[model samples]
Target: MDLRVAAAVSLLLALATTTGAVTFNATNTATGTIGGLRFDVAVGLDYANLVLSNASAFIWSSAFNQTRPADRKPVDAVTLVVAADVSGAAAFTAADVITLSAPYVGNYSGDVRTEVTGVLFHETTHVWQWDGQGHANGGLVEGVADFVRLKAGYAPAHWVKPGQGDRWDQGYDVTARFLDYCDSLKPGFVALLNAKMEDGYTDDFFAGILGKGVQQLWQDYKANYDA
Candidate 1:
């Protein structure tokens, strides 16, 4: 996808937030699949059902597409909604619903049946991810989501390049791109960072990865932007 188009999609989703409690059908069975990968979607609900269910799972699949087998199921059953215009995107505040753009679905050359599955992985991580009890940096929150997407090999073609964009924690694709740099220099770096976030988040967490603070990571990331 073109960067502009991807950015538009991201922005649309960002505005797609709702402020109501989520309701589920006790008998409501949902199945989710992406690029042909499937999984049990309801296993990790209620932990933070709003964040852990569908949204997080979709993002998770996107980030870790390469980590799963082609026939593997990522979630048991969730309604996969492919919207030509993201109309149903905002209808969900609870992460329990899997939503994807129509163009995104059509862009996959892989067996991935739907983009919603991939996007779920990223959102699912948010549900399960510890945010230092809301003290975590938003950029890192988004970056980690993309990090999962990067690791999963679903990163869009436009995401391959690095940059001295806004700030390191600029969130979403920008932060994800920087996280990719850290991962390149330090194997398992993203994993370690995720572990750290699980317990609690701190700026010093970067020290654990690069022997420097996150600010330093940002600087280093920018320095190598063109390399």
Candidate 2:
């Protein structure tokens, strides 16, 4: 290899190492059906791995600011399985494993690759996020994942708009929108909350960070964006 090229490669590898080099393994285990076949056609294992790398970079640098390994999950690898029979959900992550519903891929009417990329971002967040040692609010947890997807510019059109949900912790897009609002009030608010949840979670953390209770913040968020 040319010396310049080798030096560039070394630098990239060094950066990745500093941020924690987590292996991403992606495979389609549902190739018995057309849904799985569609995954192979629209998004092969190679692209899935790329999304994993991209999502990790985005979560650390842009969304969550978890640039250090100690600030995020310590897993050494994350696996993504594109499989069928995963009904009633587009994708979900358990521990360091992400399962994408091949059936959803086949049935989706939009850009399959783009949708999968967005789903990958959401699921990847689950793998890296601090979960309050399994005691965090489930809705807030899901919302944070969706917030990453939202920040990635992949929020679907059918999602509820700002201030549309009945509660701040309504989960998914609702809570994601609320979090976006919170981030606006205090830059890096989501990142702060995420770092706080490294070991435990409390609604009171809102007061510590923003000088207001979570409920009061929610009310202000609603009033600010309600149409």
Candidate 3:
């Protein structure tokens, strides 16, 4: 074998050994009613794997600070299910599967394509983000997910503006805004905070990272906007 060819093969083998496998599937259970929406989400599905991969990379870059695949979640596959049965929620992710509401797809008044992409980006983050070993504040967990959405340029027009939330851990867009503020104070603040939460969660993580209590940070955040 040629020396260069042997080296190329060796590199390929090494990459195959180190890289993780990720799969994505999008299914529409509300086929009949979905009509054109089905086509839109199907298009979204076509890019689901790419979206998941990109979202994972973004999540790690934004919060986890884990550049290597080995440092992130060991999820092997993610499935997006669009169902009409889910009511009162646009979407929810459990484990590695994201279930989107088909009714939401059917009734969405605005840009369904972009909206679904945003929802997918948000839900996909849930599949990759740490949950403080299930001890973290639920609001913070949700906030991190929305923060991913925010960074992806998928933030909807209705989302609360920065420094507009009532509390730091208020969850969703509110907490996302607060987390963004925290991240602004120091680069990669979310990433370090997430790394600390890998084992478990503590309020001290805030003071340790930003030199201020979480409540104090919230107060400062609010004061910045005179809110």
Candidate 4:
């Protein structure tokens, strides 16, 4: 993986992934490489688009609890790129685009489609979720995205067990586990918090949603699982 040159991009006229005005596109630049070949064999463009479309619907319905369009960031299209590069990670989303590391795809030993779909669920949350107008905690932002993935039933077995994080906003699976606990106390808790974040983020949002600060909730969350 010395250098990644953009492959001939095709604006895939997606299947039924598009709803009304929104469109989804994908391009596999590494199709000639081993990793890219695996991606095509395990997860093709049609399947990837399906995951992206279904993930978006899942986040809107479950993660946001059907929050109105005003609460959402308006992105009419999303593009996913499978590149011939070693990102040292699975995948990442910047704005409306998702980049999957072809090297990772090539090396996957198990259900690659499921794994990639799970990664899409998490990254798709980033595309839709607010970042507190760039005023939110990075950990919380990532945690919320992971929480969405968790709810989507895509949380990998390697994820930390519930109540195992060192802090409530520990980010990723750790914070995602904490958020799950908070959601249990008050259903739709995450949706409310995300709504509040549309303007800005504050720890007080926890108090407003669950009548307790995040720290106390985190402790209680841990105590429940301490067997």
Off by over 4 Å in 4: 1-20
Q: Write down the TM-score for model 2.
A: 0.91
Per-residue lDDT of model 3, residues 1-227, tens digit only: 01122232344334433675766677766676763366354445565555555665556555567767778778888888877788898899999989888878777888776777788778988898888899999999999889878876788999998779777888999999998889899988988888888899988999999999999999999998788
Candidate number achieving the greatest lDDT relative to the actual structure = 2
- lDDT for model 4, on a 0 to 1 scale? 0.81
Against the true structure, whose TM-score is highest?
2
Model 2 ranges with Cα > 4 A deviation: 1-14, 17-19
lDDT string, candidate 4, 55-118, tens digits: 7767776788653444468888889999997578899889999999999999888788888888
TM per model?
0.54, 0.91, 0.87, 0.89
lDDT string for model 1 (1-227, tens) is 21122332343234323322223222212223331122223222222233233343333233322223221223343433434444333122133444444444344455332233346546545544456656788888878876776555556655647865678888878888888888788866766666566457788888866888877777878877654
Name every residue pair that clashes in candidate 4.
none
Error of 2 at 127 (Å): 0.1
Instruction: Report backbone clashes per prediction.
Output: 48, 0, 1, 0
Full ranking by TM-score: 2, 4, 3, 1
For all candidates in order, the CA lDDT equals 0.51, 0.85, 0.77, 0.81
- For candidate 2, give the lDDT of residue 165: 88
Clashing pairs in 2: none
